[model samples]
Target: MARFFAAIGLLNLVIFSTSFLAAEEEVMTNSWHVIFKRDVDHQTAHDVANRNGFLMIMPMLGSKREYHFMHPQVKSNRKKRSIRHTKNLKLDPLIATAVQQAGYKRSKRGFKPLKSLLDEEKPIESINAFPPKKGSNEEDPLFDKEWYIKNTGQAGGVPGLDLNAEAAWAKGYTGKNITTAIMDDGVDYMHPDLFDNFNAEASFDFSSNDNFPYPRYTDDWFNSHGTRCAGEIAAKRNNGICGVGVAYNSKIAGLRMLDQPYMTDLIEASSMSHRPDLIDIYSASWGPTDDGKTVDGPRNATMRAIVKGVNEGRNGLGSIYVWASGDGGPSDDCNCDGYAASMWTISINSATNDGRTASYDESCSSTLASTFSNGKPGYKDAGVATTDLYGKCTTKHSGTSAAAPEAAGVFALALEANRKLTWRDVQHLTVLTSKRNHLEDPTAHHQWTMNGAGLEFNHLFGYGVLDAGDMVDLAKDWKTVPERFHCTAGTVKGVYKFDSKNALKLQIDTDGCRGKKNQVNYLEHVQSFITLNSTRRGDVTIYLTSPMNTTSLILSRRPNDDDNKDGFNKWPFMTTHSWAENPRGKWILFVTFSSESEEFQSGNLFEWTLMLHGTQKSPYTSQTSPLIHNTKSKLALVKRQHERAAEFQF
Candidate 1:
């Protein structure tokens, strides 16, 4: 049965209604005054930026489209906001309190304001002040227009979501009919490589209500950030300039959710754009900060809206929201932000390459970590190559913000590979199809440090940094069950085989939470997470017991998304198996064999099995996965080893 909302079409979701929101339209006009696009009963929020208080900084939202950036005052000092007795600085009480709670010390609070309040050091630096063209001194070709794809990973900076990754994923798609939206800063509307895939029709600016989202004279000019981010995710390859994007065939749309004071405004606009026929995913690389036990600012309003949209879903439009964690990492303690912790959207953390481990990483204390870089360690070894802003990208940009766009670009490719993949499916596949699991395997060069968050969905790397080949392959066989998964790289090994009539079934079904102390999946399984845990304490594990020696399992429960843990994916727990935290005894396992196994290979017998971790209960499907797919996608798989392996083979 299909239940639909009548008053507001399919997406008639009730966003947080403020007592004054209905009247906001009449009061909020522009140019001089501002409006409260949403309501604030008695909790959570601020009215508006002080008049002339609006400052244009880097889009908290990130991008990788071929950006034409300004010197963007790399002078920013990301810190915990605080209220202190100082002649030079001042802080908003609520935001400062939030920062303190988020864990940042009061003194650690401060960022170069976009504009000068009183002649203090500001964030914007004149273009002429740009560091002398010190490019080419390094090895990355992304900085050299003269170089072709050579500058990519192999050249030390892997071009994100570019041609090679796309070829395998873009089999039948051109991204024509599909439009992917990014919730970031502004786009480089003038970039040649991005214009083709750019969808102005599907784009909007939440940062500014004036309809114009391009960069301005404000401290955050050089609209290139959004463009660069977009380019990395979906730039038109084969255009013959420098390089390509992940979803070269998919249409790219932008929603300027950053660079402004009112995230509520951005959220409202994002909600209104929830049309079934218009967009696909909304990618954002911005999030709340991570403090050991403090919150420096209010939760993101746009993020709040994203949660609503996730719960309410789009106009059956199949759109998902993607966000980035913060970058105060290598600090040994991860302090990612709010959106990444929120279950409403999929959060992305950053990884470095070219030889160094994933940089831009947060302390292990954060969630949703991963890797994606213009150039890092291993580039010299992996032979991977990429295109980049070509500006002075010498410094490593490690933050959740950097990580968000990486995931978003990969997601764009997923959409290009299969336009039908809904928000839920996208998140599911990403977690299941990630590549970090192999690092834990005996055969791989397991540099445990590269594995952020420690294990699976730890605060560091969310579901392990991405793997392009695996993601593309996942998209190819996503809708179908997988059989005989070869040592395929980058994705979970859920290779399904089809019967003559095309009936479908999975090869793995392991319970999600086997044991528990609280909401967290612990230092291990956290890497695979896209959603936060029910509880925030103790521990939870989702592993299959190798046959021969198996017994009782553990099921853990904790607090909901309300406020248990810091930096957790805020949504409910979801699993590949339809089984819930408690899979009833109705579960079983079977094993069949075949002669051959390949991508298009046929005639392979399969194995089906189930193992309960905790207790038994009806409707065991993961609370999270179902919400995204509107259904359950879990099963069981066992190899000749009789090893109770997972479906999301990494």
Candidate 2:
């Protein structure tokens, strides 16, 4: 009789727990956010919501006047009904706006795990062991395989084709006193390799609406992305777990915004601006679908949050944002990805262990630098070694996803060396210090070009692979760059037509806002805001030539972009190819249609405007040989030699 009573008690507890969870899920699913007007008092808003059978949850994060509310009478699965209720809420005079809370999938930039490629099922003894080399201090078993950190060519990789992390480590700059936030699915804070460095105070879960950003587990371990990325930045050193991080002493914060049914602008904004005062760097590896056609970017709220973060975060030093240049390969152009192309973010591309462009790398002028990812097949232990989900470790992290965090780790080291570096200062350091290692474009579409300012740049590799040692050395003595200014050089307003056979060329001439407060002499980022309509948008290619005769292919042909109705509406096609160049003469633009479909297509250029962003005075005046005067002639000679060599290859 006693045993029977105990079983009944257990049954009742299970029933109660199930009922409570169901209620909580119902509340979460039926939630809607309503932005109240400034004039509406909280008491009045509460009374109105109560009269309408709504219960207040709380205020939305990163929003001033937005409040979350739920209607008990509304069914959780009735999305259309929930949306209708929000529409009705918008009709109230006290409410400024309303939106139903929902979830959407944010694509992880890393390649999905393949059973054939992954060695997760293999026993520890079955994997080939790489003994640590001489003078190595890392005791972690996987350190020998981390070629990107200190490449010794353990896996058929080229020696010294690495980020030179050891050099920075030698200088005792291991990202101390800095925090980097990984904005992804969620982080395994409990993982032994990362637990020591995880900053719980700066972490949050917008998806689950909780303070704990722990990843929700699954059978297939699909949510290991954030954990891997975090491990790349802050996994503990000499932990006897996994390989050491590039910034092993830096703090890691997990902002869990992805891994939901659908993504909302509020979630994105909250993640981007979360604890900006505490989180110095925001590392993001996810973006719009890389299906070779999608053109998407941050929404209005997210855009505002990013702008606010960079302008006001980190005690006005500006929050640093590192982004992954998309992995859409040769068919897609990253110029369409606004997040990567934005002047506010540092877009990073990927190179392989062999120092070649990754097979899936997308070429664009906006990519700021390159980092090592994974090598080709048949190379032993070529993938990145980092911590995985559930206290495990992985040797298969690959993609621009892996590359971005490494760049973030490098930036963290720089920050530790100099805490006063602003967002723009980091970009300047990257352009000035990044090296032209052995990275090459296998497609041969983009060759190394020497700008008028003598800076070498490539569409595939940007300025070049990051050199942590050089970056830190420069950061230690780096002065804040001159205050940035924007100048509108010229605008050409007219409709010009072009067909497949004949290309359309337009020119704009101006003094670059000379004799004004916003005068720009040295160039930084150049933007060509264009509006056009094409019969087949995918066939259109746009190129811009700076006054210095340096040409930038701002927009390449996207064969998969078949949309003909939308075209481009004042799309800001940007390029860094003209960095440090003068913008005071005639600028030329060429728009042509190239297609193999045998379909004759035409396009109309509705308007063209040239915008220049730089400083009135030279930013390099503090350094020796300002404007790279000593290298100009040498660079020009190399350019001519390269052109001659290309002539024979073609």
Candidate 3:
């Protein structure tokens, strides 16, 4: 690990853009981050930064005191500073110097060290796009071509393993009154099939800070990805253009954030919370690079945004977040992704048209369910058909990226069936209505394990393909789940060192969960925060076993990942494999290094923490403030209508 670090500098604040805007006077624009020592008063820190130079201040979402400050670019007179571009200047040295000159002394309890610094970290994004097959020029043309919607055994697909969207539409649960925000590149809302269902008020362009979240002229390569994804959710029905969406009556919006040159954590947070009150679900088809390497997740601000949205969005019912597990089947594991592995989000994987798992799916316990997307490689099966940019239609959408929106669309139908369902209720319905043993692909794994709750789940298929009809039907009579309950095993502070060929095992007993104020019998999601030192991160694999003997392979070896630039730094590994498992008894975590790998011979498990999320037997008033929107989603519709009315009068 030390050698790897010497080879690659720390993965900290990275400057991707060549240009930064600065004004002559009154500070037009500046980008810098400050993390004060613990116990620093918020007002004092803000005043200090302002006195130095930072004028625009915003609190970092996750941290209690960390603040991100920016200076505006004024057009008029400005005093000159040596640092002209925010990207070039490292603010830490200047801030430290300024504080020292001001005779600011460190707190007695605070150790002597540099606590504040610039936040410049950037995250990588990989998009999913497959070659599209041209559709026929006929009425309701592409409907028959969309095997993912209704297989009919077309192109080697199974007859009934599709999402059953046709049956869902037959029941009149077409996602009415539901709005989904696609957090990706951009959506071609003007496309004929998407224009009618587009919701402008629910959309925003975080990259450009504009109201219209459409693809710009600079980047055509990535623009169509979001549009195709949106088409899978709410393309206009009977449009005579493209295939119908799973939830044809649902409203779709776009939050353009990923197409920019630099994808900073701050920008991602803005996108994650864009009009959460108006949008029911935030669909994300993009994540860290799927190169069978990089292990990364949302930074502080983004993490805070996700938590905030799930707790407060939808007028307090909570916003539903849908994430693609990943497309790195050959090597990567979805557990490495913080977003998909989070308990607050629904992680979805892709299945082929024939009901088989996609070849590129990264199997992990974090995945909750599967949905139809593209077909297996070297096979004649067809991929999904949906609208694209330039006012056209295509059938090339594939990958888990394509599968997540399909799941989101199903949830939209469920939401339409029962508007009062909370985010947790949506997850329950997903687990309940998902079908097992539906895929017919010969190459895919077919193993199924019956969980303690009598529900069967497979890592490859994630409780099997989503059943749109069944989900909506269940939603019709779904009772709101009891309030969420959590239990924690205090931090393990010891460093257990080990060499190759030996496994490190640690156990914790719940004692019928007496420690928890609320008794928990079943589990929803389990998370482990681990800090480790490994010679080769790619050679490490971790597993968690529940008392029921269900073992989840949470961290798989990634051969391409050689550097631990961040050294595990309390990284979290989560699993949904324990759903409905007895929360009492013993839970074990096993960490191991591959003996077969001669290079990775040694490592140390520095620290670990365990957390459990589920429900109690009886309902109690939730400590979390109820976020129920008194007016509900209808408020957004009314606003949209008013905007259209004002536009028409002019």
Candidate 4:
């Protein structure tokens, strides 16, 4: 029998006695959440909860087994109920017992009360200075200021250290029929430069629970983050006022979920899933706190949404998600962020105008590629020129925040080039086409090494900067990659300690090939799960080496991070530096406490696991056939190229 919370009699409200509280008595509300066995229905779960002493129970949105329930009276000694309150009252175990007696096993469970996951995320602000105008007469007035799109020695930017968007644009691939959703605070859809391609039908304001995804505060400096991001991807081409976007003809929608007073996991999930059918690319510039000490990512609902989007969106072509690597500077690692590390998202970092890593870019092995953005540390830099709040234009748009949307715009051009590309196909093309050593001076000292497949990779710079022309060129002829294969190594369990003078090492061996035909000769991502205890996490440095001797400095010591709390509790660090490596040999993980400060003590490595995700050596038929669609697309593309060539003829 299914148990529906709505069927419960009027969902009775029980008020407890307030006199039992102190003079400064706090309102203690008690509730419990549980995920019953999959076989159990809503009615049965309701009965189970009612029999277990829950006074009022309600199901969580989108989940039938999962529910939220309230007790008749306060049992704990706190002003408000918390995870501790639930534990102290033994609510989790009690609910577990009740569900078990009801003949259903709990496949998923949670004890902590659901609260706002939004805490700390600062937008990367563009520097105050603007670049000089060097665009030709036919170009947008501010086009020369967009060093990230057209780096032609303007504003001290190294020539050619850009996305090569102009080259793609010159070929008439200006992001037609592509729609990217800016999953940020909000976007100024009416801005003159953005209005032409604004996707109002796909827009939604989850922050305000409205249909229009517009900034709440039109004049506020912070409200412009989304607009700036949108401008980077789809600002109108040759608009005369502001600079052009990477995909100037592409459409963009704003899914307003961030910048609210409180953002729960459900809101974020909704934002991520909103109009997945319509939004081809989901561009997000925000994530967990980047304070160098915090480690977090999307919660349960949001994770489900991410998986769903990639699996079901775009009629199974898969939605392309572009995420900013982070702005936590040298101290932070992008691996700590779940969204950036996920295979579903293309994590992007930032390079400065001078062809160097941006000062605020967080280094990590998970970063796939990067693009030019703003200034570097100790150097005056010119930021990206883009649309701002209140129908204004600004020359200051910087950070990985700006880098993500720029990548999104470039991707739109790729989608236009060939509409048959899947999410994985896009990543494969990026890795194959991204440039290396384009930076005038890479700030990170790690030298680039050839992975097992002979692809150059650097921990700080990712595969390298995204080459718009190259990606589009490759994407046009790109066949979908072979079937994806995932393999996990044995888990390492035990407490171990080490320091700079003595590094602790562990090795796990693997057979690169899984089945007879599905050998993993090339790599897409390498994930390392580490559960350890440390007195000072900032003191720890980790290195992961592939069988090919390609080393990734996974963790770098942060001088400012002195938090003594538990460090890296079952955190998964990912790396793309091992691309194309044969996974057949032993992989080594090196953990060392490098800080000499006495404040840092030795740590314990309780357990670790290594998971590899990559493509098979042999091609296989995919569940979805893109070839039929590509056939038509190829014809259209050839026609366009020929027409473009004729137009260019003198």
lDDT tens string, model 4, 1-650?
A: 01112112111110010011111233333445466556366677667667656643445544565655555554423344454435533454434422110000100000111231112222233221233244623446677778787777777767878898878887789999999999887898877778779989999886556788888773235567788889988877654657788998999999987765434555666777777778899998887666676566665556666766776677777789999988888877777677787767899888887767776788788888888668443333377788877667766567788888888988999999999888888887677667784653354476666665556777777778888886777677666766676666557888777754667999988776456443465577787878776777788888999887888887788766666655766576778887655566889999988775655377779878787777554221221234324533322333233344335321
List, residue by residue over 1-650, the lDDT tens digit for candidate 1: 12122212212211211111011122211211112223322212212122213322112122111101111222122232222211111243322211111111111111223352224321122122122243312221232321112223344544442223434453544344556676666665545556567777777665454455564444332233455566656655444333455556677776765654333332433432444256667766544433333222223334334544543444443457765555443322322233344334565655444323343444332243354543434333221122223221212222344445556666766666666565655655665545443222122322333111112333334446565555665565455221100110011233343332332332233333334222111111111211222122212222222212211111121112123343232211222212112221122222112112232212221222221221121111222222224222121111111122122231
Q: Pick the candidate with the highest lDDT.
A: 2
Worst 10 residues of 3 by lDDT: 101-110
TM-score between model 2 and native: 0.86
* Selected candidate, larger lDDT, 2 vs 3: 2
**What's the distance in Å from true for residue 1, model 1?**
8.0
Per-model TM-score on C-alpha atoms: 0.50, 0.86, 0.76, 0.76
Q: Assess candidate 1 and give its TM-score to the true structure.
A: 0.50
By lDDT, the candidates rank as 2, 4, 3, 1
Clashes of 1: 127
Q: Please tell me which predicted candidate would have the highest TM-score against the true structure.
A: 2
User: Candidate 4, overall lDDT?
Assistant: 0.68
Number of clashing pairs per prediction, in order = 127, 6, 17, 6
Greater lDDT among 2 and 4 belongs to: 2
lDDT, residue 206, model 2: 76
What's model 1's lDDT at 616?
Answer: 20
TM-score of 3: 0.76
Lowest-scoring 10 consecutive residues by lDDT in candidate 4? 101-110
